[model samples]
Target: MNLQVLQQLGMSERDITLYLALFQLGPSSIRDIASHTGINRGTTYEALKQMAARGLISYAPKGKRRFFRAEEPDKLLELAEEKRASLEQTIDSLKTEIIPGLHHLKPEFSSGNVRFYEGDDGIEFVLKDILATVGKLEEKTYSVFSTKSIRHHLYRPFPNYTAQRIKQKINVRVIALGEGGEDAEYSERKWLKTDGQVDASYIAIYPPKVAMISMASENYPVATVIESPDIARAQQVVFEALWRFL
Candidate 1:
């Protein structure tokens, strides 16, 4: 049976078995249900107690013993709907109140920060950082050192990066290590000749941060972001010196 719905409803595996057992053996005592479900009696009772709290099952007195039965299956749907509404409220609170309050608790000054990410998703975050960090600057510009080897993989995670950059009016200056880099609006490109194939790598110097992306063993994409104004400025200086030379 596809029990994904039950799992999504936050039902544990033991609870699922006990719940179905209750369905098959209606109005049964705890001992009968435990024997039928093969779960220990104590665990079975605990599961039933929690399930009852969620309105999944209920019990009443029958002669000398209590008999348990599964509530209407539709109760599961109601529980799910309630969870959805709660989640929406939580998200709103996070956006409106929680996040800003937490930010205030963070340190005012950081000498350095470094983060590492792996695979396509990681590279996408690095690209997003480039846009978010640079877009806020007075210059709204950054520089890139890209190699032809990594050209294909660089934008694979973010094919629309250039379009988004253009929309944001963010400008880039690219120094292509080998041939084969495209030009886009609000961008300047200059190439440097190389004798042999260079390793797949990309570097972006956005003020207050520098992002590096490259292919590791087995062609896995990896990225590192360093948030240091001093380091960023030094790298920017090197890039500008090379830009003027080329």
Candidate 2:
């Protein structure tokens, strides 16, 4: 069997070894398990305790001694479902309790907090941050100065970004530098003349944060997220002015 998959499902090396040994030698004692797996008796006992606690194994007394056996294979699926439900509960707690408490500790109007991200995955991180921070307010909108260069970089990593944004009901106003972008629901686009100068950079103006993405790097894509209300407002004003002119 693929032991690595058991490890991925939160089983430790000792646990996997002991479980496999138990499966092979059905209704075995601790001495038999240790002898089969070449593990020390004390460690084997501890692993058996843990596995039994997790419902992966069970034991029943046979006269003066007890024999341990692996639970039905279907129990592994039940254990995985339990882990998934636990993880969902943790995520909910972090969102409702932990994250807001941490936010409260942040200084108001602090020096521009800038974070750098690299590669395609990093670019997707920045985009997801925008979607998550905007919340679900119908009137909330953000502005963007999008270029063809950055679009090419982002399209592959986040092909469904626009569809996800629309699904979340977030609105955007964009100024496309150097042509060709379609109008979508909850989004407005206008073209800008690059005048034979394509900078290969994109700017997104979301309140309290402004993101600048550079697709000019030959090696990989890069993104910078600046968290400063003043800077974001300034960029928004510039985008609005250009929006009016276009």
Candidate 3:
């Protein structure tokens, strides 16, 4: 049987070996158990002590010597249940005490900041963050400079992002830098010159934030989120001017 599962349940390898050895050898002495499991005597003795403390093993004194034997296999299941209960209690304590303490430790800043995210998962995080932060009001809208290359990277992983936005009734205005993304409900799209003039970068303006996503590199997808209201407003102004011209 695979004893790695026991290790995952928090029993050490030496403890597992010693326990199994005891189970097979039926109340053997420490030296015999160590020899049977190919573990050193000192380490075997220490593991037996710890396992006995956990009720996985027991010892009996016979004259001047001691013999160790494994408890019934049912005890292993009981130990596992106890561990699970202890872990649930620890999680509750962390949620109530540690997490709130850490949240209060975060410093507040006045000026806006920039955060960078990389890889496909990181890009998904950015998209989810946007969805969570933006309000659900009908008048709320965001603008984007969408490009085919970035969309190719994004849509494969997050196929339902636009659908989710539409479901949430969030409106978007998009300026396409190249060809081929359809305009869905609750969105407006305008195209720019598509004759290989634009690179594979996307910019989004959502009031207090401007996100620049780049998919041009061979390494990984990258995104930079700037949380400056002044910069976002400037980008929105430029986008509106170009929108009118187009």
CA lDDT, every prediction?
A: 0.90, 0.86, 0.83
Task: Sort all candidates by TM-score, best to worst.
Answer: 2, 1, 3
* Model 2: per-residue Cα lDDT over 1-246, one tens digit each: 577688767899889988888888999988889999999989999889988898899999988878999999898988888888999999999999999999888887555488999998998899998898775435668888888766778756888999989998899998999977778999999998878858777888888899999864664888999998899989988888888998
Return the TM-score for each candidate structure. Answer: 0.67, 0.71, 0.66
Residue-wise C-alpha lDDT for candidate 3, range 52-159, written one tens digit per residue:
898889999988889998888998899788889999999999999999998677555333367888888878888876776675434668899988776778755577
Q: Please report, as a residue range, the 10-residue window in candidate 1 with the lowest summed lDDT.
A: 103-112
Backbone clash tally (model 2): 0
Q: Give the higher-TM-score candidate: 2 or 3.
A: 2
Best by TM-score: 2
What is the clash tally of candidate 3?
Answer: 0
Pairs of residues at least 3 apart in sequence or in different chains that clash in candidate 2: none
What ranges in model 2 sit over 4 Å off?
A: 1-10, 13-17, 20-26, 35-42, 53-66, 69-92, 110-112, 135-140, 154-160, 166-169, 183-186, 215-220
Model 3, global lDDT: 0.83
Ranking by lDDT, best first?
1, 2, 3
- When 1 and 3 are scored with lDDT, the better candidate is 1
* TM-score of candidate 2 against the unseen true structure: 0.71
